[model samples]
Target: MNDHPHQSSSLTAQAGLPSELNQHNRRADDSAWIEVVQHMDSIYADLVHYQVELEEKNSALEDAQLFIQSVISSISDILIVCNINGEIQQVNHALEEIIGKTAEELLDKPISSLFCEQHLSLIAEFPEHIRSGSLIDCQIELISSEQKEIPMAINCCARFDHENRLSGMVVTGRPLGELRKAYSALHQAHEKLKTANLQLIQSEKMASLGRLVAGVAHELNNPISFLYANMHALKNYQQKFKTYIDAVHVNTSHDELQKLRSQLRIDAMMDDINPLVEGSVEGAERVSEIVQNLRKFTTPQEQKKQSFNLILVIKRAISWVLKAAKTSPEVIHNYPAELNIISNEGYVHQILINLIQNAIDAMDHRGQSKLVITVNKNDDSVQLHIHDNGPGIKQQNLVKIFDPFFTTRTVGSGTGLGLYISYGLATEQCQGDLTVSNHKDGGAEFILSLPLEAGK
Candidate 1:
C-alpha cells in the first residue's frame, strides 16, 4: 500500500531476480571494471616510455649539433656558407682569422666583396653553376680587411634542401702559400739529386779511364821506340858519309877513299835511308793519333749536345779499342757513310769503345771471330746492332746483365761496369736505349737504339 511506482519496480526486480543471478551480474561488472583499470595502467606506462624515447632523441640531436659546430670552429681551413642570393649567411672562425673580420660584420655582405676585383667574376658565376650540383675547385685571391691579398684554393659545392632544390653553397678554402713553399723545397731537392748523379757518372768514367791507362801506355811505346831507333841509324849514316867526304878532300889515295866509302856501305845505305825516313814519319803520325784519341776520351768537357757524323765517331772508337785489345777481332761496319746523330760525341765514343772491347773479349780462342756492327735508320731513330761471333750469354745471366757491378769475368779481368756505364750513357744522357740478346746463329747481340734528335 505504501509503494510508489519507482519503489514498486525496484521491489519487483529484487523479488523476481534470483540471488545467484544478482551475484553473477555483480561479478561480471567487477571483471569489466578490472579490465578497464588494467588498460588505463598499460596506456600510462606506454606514454611514459614514449616520453623517455623522445627525450633521448632530442639529446642525440643536440649532441650532433654541438659536434658539427665544434668541427666548423676548430678546422684550420676557411669555411663559408652563402645563401642563393650570394650573400654571406654563415662562416667559421677560420674565415674570421683569414679575412680579419667578425662573423657579424661579414653577414649579409656579398661574397664577392671578399675576393680580389679581378676574381669577383668567378665568385659571381659560382653560385649560378653550383645549382647544377657540381663541385668546382679554383685558385682565387681574397682581399683581407687589412687590404693584403691572400691566395687560396677553394672547393665549392651546392647545398640542397630535402626537395632537391638548391638552398645555398658551402665553400671551403685553404691557403696556398705553404703548398707553394713545399713545392719549391721539392724542386731544390730534385736538382741536388740530379747534380749528384752526374758527379757519380763522372767518377765512374774516371775509373774506366784508369783501367785503360796501361794499355794506352803500351800503345804509345811502340811508335816511340821505332822512331828513336830510326833516328840512331840516321846519325850513324851521317857520320860515315862525312868521313868519306873528308877522305876525298884530303887527297887520299884512290884505294883509301874507296875503302872509306865501302866501309859506310853508302850505295846500300842510300837505298835503306828512304824506307827508314818513311817509317819514322809514319811512326810519329801514329803516336800523334794515339795521343789525340786518348785526350778525346779522357778529357772532361761540358755536356753540350750537338749534331755530328756518327760514322766518324765509330771509326775513332774502333781505332782506340784496337790499341788496347788483346786480339784483333775483325770489325764489320754496316752503317751509312754519313749517318748523323745529335748527342754528346765523347759519351757516344765511350759507349762504342766499351762495346767493341767487350765483343773482342767474348771471342776468346773461338776461330773466325767477328764483330758485325750494323746501323740502320728508321723514322725518328737510329738503331745500331753489334753482333759478335762467340759463345752467347747464358739465359740465367741475361736478366742481371744490366745491373751495376754484375759480370761474368774474373775479378782482376773486369770491373763489371763497362756494360752498366754504357747503358746509363745511352738511356740517361742521350735519351736512348741499350738492350742485349743472344744471336740466333751464335754469340751475343747488343742492340743500341738512339734518337736522331737530341733529348728526344
Candidate 2:
C-alpha cells in the first residue's frame, strides 16, 4: 500500500509541470501579437499622410496648368512652341485663328508647313540662327488656311529646359499690316503736334507785336516829327533864297538886295542848313533802323542760321521791350561792346525780347526797379543772365514757369506762352538751355545758354 501512494504522487507532479509550461507559451504568443498590431498601425498612419501630400501637390499642379493656359490664350500675338526638330508642339489661340487651323490639326506638324513656300528656306535657317542668338523682327510670309500669303514680322528665341539646355523654340509674330498702321498713326500724330506748335508760336508772336504797336507808333512818330520840322525849315529857307536871288536877277540895287537878305535871314539860314540837314539825316536813319528791326521780328524764322552781333541784338531787344513797357526800369549792361555768335538771329531776338519783356512786367508797381544783364563766355558756349530787382518768382512757379499756358497774370492780360515758347526755341531750335531762379539779392534771374556752333 505504501509503494502505490508514492507512484500516484509522482504522476500528479508531472501533469502539473506540463500545464504550467502551456500557460507560459500562451502568454508569450499574446505579447508578440500586440507588437505586430502596433507596427501595422504605424505603417497605416504613414500611408494616410503620404496620400494627403500627394493630393495637395496634384491641386497645385492643376492650378499651374490653368494659369499657363489662360496666359497662352490671352496673348494677342501669334505664338508657336516647337520642338528641337522644328515640329510644332503647341500653339496659342492667335496662331490658330490666323492660320485657320485648330491645335489638333497643327500639333506635331513641321514648322515649315505654316510658312509660305518662298519662306521655307528662311524658316529652316531660323533654328540654326536661334542657337547662336535670337532672331528679332524677321520679315516672313505665312500661309493661311486659304493658302494666302500674309506678311509677318516674327521674333524667335530658343526655349530652355530645367537643365538650361535648349529644348525648343518659341516664335511670336505680329502682322506687318498692323505694324505699318501703327507707324502711320504715330507719324500723323507727330505731324499734327508740330503744326499745332508752329501755330502757337505764330499766334504768340502776333500777340507780342500787337502789344508793341502803340510803342512802335510812338517810336515812329518821334523821327517823323523831327523830319517834318526840319523839312519845313528847309522849305522856308529855300523860298527866302529864291526871293533874294530874283531881286538880284532883276538888277535891284545892292543895298536893297542886302536889305532883302537881312529880312530873309540869309546868313543865319546858311549857318543852320548844315546842322538841320545832319539832324534830318540822323532822324531818317533812326526810322530806317527801327523799321528794319520790326521787320526782322515779324518775319518767320529762317532755316539757315547766320553769324550776328549778340550785344547789338540784346540792345535792340531791350529798346523794343522798354519802349512798350509801362514802367521804366533802369537797365545795367554788363557785357563787352559786342559778342558775335552763329545761330538763328531771329530766334535769339525773339527770345531776348520775351525775356526782357517778362522782366519789365515783373518790375511793374515796384519801386526803383532795376534790371542787370550779364554775359559770360565759356569754352564752347555763351551764357546770358538777366536779373531783375522785383518780387522774385514764387518757388512753386519757378518749376512750372516754362510750361505752356501756365500763368499767374489776370485774365486776358497774358497768354502765358511767352516763357514756354522761349524755352522751346532756346533748347530745341538752338540746341541751348534756359533756366530761371531767384537771385541772391532778391529778384528773378533767367539764364540762357547757347552753343557756339550750330547743331548738325
Candidate maximizing lDDT: 2
Off by over 4 Å in 2: 1-28, 212-456
Error of 1 at 263 (Å): 21
lDDT of 2 by residue, 43-141 (tens): 999999999999999999999999999999999999999999999999999999887989999999999999988888888887898888756458898
- Alpha-carbon local distance difference test for all models: 0.82, 0.84
Model 2 weakest 10-residue run by lDDT: 1-10
Q: Write the per-residue lDDT of candidate 1 for residues 170-207, one digit (tens) a residue.
A: 88999999778988999999999999999999998896
Model 1 has an lDDT value of 0.82
RMSD of each: 13.6, 12.3
Please give the lDDT score at residue 229 for candidate 2: 78
What are the TM-scores, per candidate, against the unseen true structure? 0.42, 0.47
